[model samples]
Target chain A: MLNTHGLDVSAAIKTLVLILDLVGTFVFALSGALAGAKHRLDFFGIMVLSFAAGNFGGITRDLLIGAVPPAAITDWRYLAVSILAGVLTFFWHPAIERLRSAVLVFDAAGLALFAVAGTQKALAFGLNPAMAALLGMLTGIGGGMMRDVLLTEIPAVLRAEIYALAALAGATVVVIGQLLLLPSAIMAIIGAVLCFAIRMLAIRRSWNLPAPPD
Target chain B: MLNTHGLDVSAAIKTLVLILDLVGTFVFALSGALAGAKHRLDFFGIMVLSFAAGNFGGITRDLLIGAVPPAAITDWRYLAVSILAGVLTFFWHPAIERLRSAVLVFDAAGLALFAVAGTQKALAFGLNPAMAALLGMLTGIGGGMMRDVLLTEIPAVLRAEIYALAALAGATVVVIGQLLLLPSAIMAIIGAVLCFAIRMLAIRRSWNLPAPPD
Candidate 1:
């Protein structure tokens, strides 16, 4: 439980959430850098890719909700984090090549964490349940979408298994929990884990929604 | 100059606005395409760059104002325009290379038109005047900033010229016009041209804001 906007919560839990968010940003940024390296992007292009992947979803979400100028712009710390991540990846990426799947796993964890955070924020902002779910999905996937667009490739989200759908599920649970009078702490934990579990299961089982009739 | 929501205005001026907007899109897309060619980017990268240059600002504005999914997502026409512009540039850039300055003029005109239109839309949505003005500025410069970032460069907005300031002026006039009971037609025309003139003057005179003392 972190004190967010004056809410009382366990310090450990709250700190964990913050950690996950930072880690998510780090992993996503790393993924972008790896992609840039693959494309032989210049140093500037690598940094740009990392920054966009780390920040685009959050920026898009905040603006859509009228959080004008967005946290990304207002909080220099976040920008610093992205810049640091970009620089770190630029220096250490040769060592990363030994484990090709590592970046993928990091990105997967980011996907789950971001999905929960985005969904909860949307619900808190007074959006309808379905729209909240949609927003969560959008936020979870938007960073990758922006990255792909910038890199001039189709976004992996358009082809991935249940990635956004997992976010939608977590958002739906939050809405349901609210209606059922579940404790906020319990709801948050359950929702976050549900997002992670669903995503993990999808990956392990190679699960994906069947293609619609063409 | 055109009717929006419940507001009615002159149709002739609306046509002019549309034409100006398209011309702006053409030049903006050209800038994006040129960047792609500089990098020897693939076809996908070229299209993506063109799309970002032409659409990012408008998309940002719309989403911030609660226009969900934004026109850039729901409308195919915008995508079509970007693709067409990119294809044309790819095929005929050699001829256009002689008219680089002229393209800047067109881009400046676009900045003005988009600024006014963004402000007008914000007002229609009942946002505060200051916020409306900010949104207008964002709309005018957002796409180019995005394009630059994608190409891994500093945003032009931070460099020089009255781009965002011009948008702010145009939007401010719309706000004042509404208060003064001025005609919408006159307000839009004057506002847009004021934006264009301010930008052109800045360009011609090499006007710039001083950087903060380092």
Candidate 2:
């Protein structure tokens, strides 16, 4: 059995969470850069969109939980990751566009990671379970929503996707695990896996929430 | 001369700020609802847009300043004001639309109020003068940006007009007043008036920022 209660384990979990967060930021930044390229925005505009898509979610989550300055603003790593993604996409977008499926996979992974991490952070901040779950979903979807918004598109989550539902399900799992006193690191993994699976399956099956009739 | 340091005076200022905030909320909500109606969205959609536009700026400002739960989320007044505006617009959109000029005037008022109020709040929270001014501009523009985003339109502040610049000028006035040890209420009034004047003049003169060549 793993010593989940050990100080070392907690520190390791924290480091792991940070790594996953950076990964998510990178992929979302890629999406933002791609969107900016599609719109033929200038290099500076692409960089702005990349950073907005990479960090808006975490920034919003931190602000909502009263974490002053937000990690995206305070941590240099977030900025570096976003800039790296933006530069790559700007210079090599044709190659990136050819890997659309791969990008979708990375986006799904990012969504799952953000949802679980956001839930854990909210819980740590003493938010109630319900609110924590909601915030988690918000954290997962916020970047994409902001990206779409900046590009003048209706947010997919509010339109035709099963995106937010997957995040909410993952967040709910984390919240339930917390209630059951499960090891948080393990629960985070399970929740993220569940979210990633659901999102991937939805994509494969073309699953969509019902929309108002045209 | 008013005793600016007196507890009673401070309380009065607080009340006055609240009133102005509510007024801003109401006018922004009206704009959102009107936008929804123009887009032919249903009543529910209009209400959602209204509430989002009315509260998003204040909520964002509070969150950035580490105020938990946000005044918009915690206070019933904000909700009531948004709902009132939404209901009014939903039922009487034609009559309201006929007053297009009046709506523009109200929007200017809302922008001015939000800019000064956001700057004051950020300063109170110990943010630097530069950041406070930026946040003030953000607060003034955020709601309309969100409304436009939801409707899949480019944000007006980003594309054209002197909208955000006007807000920044207003916020700068408040920040300078604070630095000079001036009374906050007087500064807020001056800032609001200056912002309102600038926005109205821009509308009258059809002023626009330079755009990229087509």
Candidate 3:
């Protein structure tokens, strides 16, 4: 019953989204691998950390939203991507560290993509708008949080710049777009751009959430 | 085609399992809250840690096995039990800390219970035996792992006494019992007792996994 033109358009959009997801996974994996290198973890440890950092956020979100057997576990491509990132970082951390700003930008991009994707997934699963938005933020920050925890550090999401808040902004935008019945491709782009812009600005301006009184 | 006596027996077993599960949740919550208190976290942080410690293991297990809308979220009693334990620990940490041996015993009990329960749940959901057993161990140790991470400490499971191994033993027993078509109640009890005994022995004798050479 579907028109060929409509099917082609949807397929192209899906392909675009999938590429974005893989890019997000790769950047996150690189970050995890870098953290492992900084800590002098063994090779196996680096790979494990890379996979955890790249996939844990989506895994957690999938678990919470009842998307069981998470994509991270079931999909071989994700595993390959994370491992490749780890191997690359392990071999070239010195060079990568010099590109810290670039890493941050990629991380921000990943956060944007994850926030929109997570929100859309939650809505698909029939969650309320508020909870969906929260899950989106969680999906954006959860992997980094887990990575820091494994390194025995307080999560950056809890202590650093407006990371979680930016994800929240993006997710909220997605939810509003849902309410307005906007095309998902357009909404995702808008939400991702908003999140990426806010995160970059936070980094540039050194914006931080208020800390608890010591 | 339902038999009255069979239904009664099943219902009674279910009740027993539920009671054991709640008890396990409470002890885990107590340990988490105690850790939070040690770190000088505020009341809200303590509550969050308690909830994470009490429920994350089961949540993880449920997610892996495709149990949607995990019981920890949908069931009110689990929330109440974790909250109560947190409140008690926050107000009485000094007294609780004085009873370190008692706390360890309770932790072991919870570990045993969760191991058996998690394995059974996985089996019920039709996971392969080896996978179910692994999930059971994860159910036993996952919460504490998350708790330690949140507190910026290495998980005891990765560095301490025979924690995860004991859970695996218990879960293996459940799997073997299932293969033999043993009664659920008896299998659960046997598995729990075995896990608890092994854990207690390991603590008493200072058993540890082999560490990497420095």
TM per candidate: 0.56, 0.61, 0.61
Residue-level lDDT tens digits of model 1 in B67-118: 7677777868778888987887777777666678998888888888888888
Q: For all candidates, state DockQ relative to the true structure.
A: 0.07, 0.16, 0.17
Which of candidates 1 and 2 reaches a greater DockQ?
Answer: 2
User: For each model, chain A TM-score?
Assistant: 0.86, 0.93, 0.94
B108-196 per-residue lDDT for model 2 (tens digits): 99999999989988998999999999889888988888888798887778988888889999999999999999987788899999999
Worst 10 residues of 1 chain B by lDDT: B205-214
Of the two candidates 1 and 2, the one with more favorable TM-score, higher being better, is 2
Q: Which clashing pairs does model 3 show? A: none
State the weakest 10-residue window (summed lDDT) of model 2 chain B: B1-10
Q: Candidate 1, residue B1: CA error in Å?
A: 33
What DockQ score does model 2 reach against the true complex? 0.16
* Residue A89, candidate 1: C-alpha displacement in angstroms: 2.2
Clashing pairs in 1: A1-A10, A1-A13, A1-A14, A2-A14
Q: Could you tell me the lDDT of residue A183 within candidate 2?
A: 84
lDDT of 3 by residue, A149-209 (tens): 8888866565457788899899999999998898877888899999999999999999876
Writing each residue's lDDT as its tens digit, candidate 3 over B1-214 gives 2366556766677788889899999999998888877776656567667888999999888877878767785676887899898888878888888988998998899999999999999999999999999999999999999898787787878987899999999999999999899887788889999999999999999999898999
